[model samples]
Target: MMQMPELLHSQKNSLFTAMNRFIGAVNNMDQTVMVPSLLRDVPLQKRDPDHGSYLRDAEADMYTYYTHLKSIRNEIEWGVLREDQRRKERAANTAVNAANLEAEGEDGNDLEQLLQYHLKGLHGVLAKLTSQANNLTNRYKQEIGIAGWGQ
Candidate 1:
């Protein structure tokens, strides 16, 4: 049996609308959500026109954002590749298993022998499907041009 999640409500407000809205806003991941806090907190300092180190915190923030964004993008890309590799492996295994089952029968006149022949046909279909899937995965990997991540 499954139970519904309880709605959170303030004593003054009967509905959970405010809490739900806040949760949704938090997950939106819009950089605008952080802008007001950043503007209020980070002080801007003027520097000489010729100096190299101008507004250190702002520069730091830019670098921080850059590194973190790059890290996350690479992580997701590698994750996708790994998932696709697993999928291809599973499909190939299915084809092999089907082929093995089809090869196990020797009595051609038996009812099970007919089923085996049908299964053998299904095995060929599965093998083609797996081959096409692997080909597509390889093509996508090439198009994306991501060789590897963190290695």
Candidate 2:
């Protein structure tokens, strides 16, 4: 029911807010986890069935997640992807576009619908990223026996 301008403005605001929160969370995690070595061999708690299970290597999972969060933070700050990631993303996008073209027949609302779908997905991902960064920070503290300092 929103006018075009209102919808655009709202979407932009939500996206920016999510991005900023994620960046801040990652920055806090980076500052907190000074010794990545300590993250080695640490295992994250098992998630609820609905939330999905972690099949990653428990010994390296925390370190990997830590590095990934920082990488995402850097990408967001720089507004660019690493070459390998960009290449993979381009290939995925091409496949998705081809599928969409074949499935969606020239609906006037297609582009708008696609944009909204992606925006919603992006928002969910950002929120999850922020939570992960915070969790990593908290877990690192616990690993080093500094539990309950900044939960």
Off by over 4 Å in 1: 1-110, 147-151
**Residue 75 of model 2, lDDT score:** 85
Give the per-residue lDDT digits (tens) of candidate 1, residues 27-138: 3323222332333333333344588554444543332433343344344335535777889988999999778758975444765777777766655544443343333233
* Cα lDDT, model 2, residue 20: 95
CA displacement after TM-score superposition, residue 36 of candidate 1 (Å): 35
Q: Would you give me the overall lDDT of model 1?
A: 0.43
lDDT of 2 by residue, 89-112 (tens): 999999998888778765659878
lDDT of 2: 0.84
> Number of the top candidate by lDDT?
2
Question: What RMSD does model 2 have?
Answer: 6.0
Would you list the C-alpha lDDT of every candidate in the order shown? Answer: 0.43, 0.84
- Using all chains and alpha carbons, the TM-scores for the candidates as numbered come to 0.26, 0.68
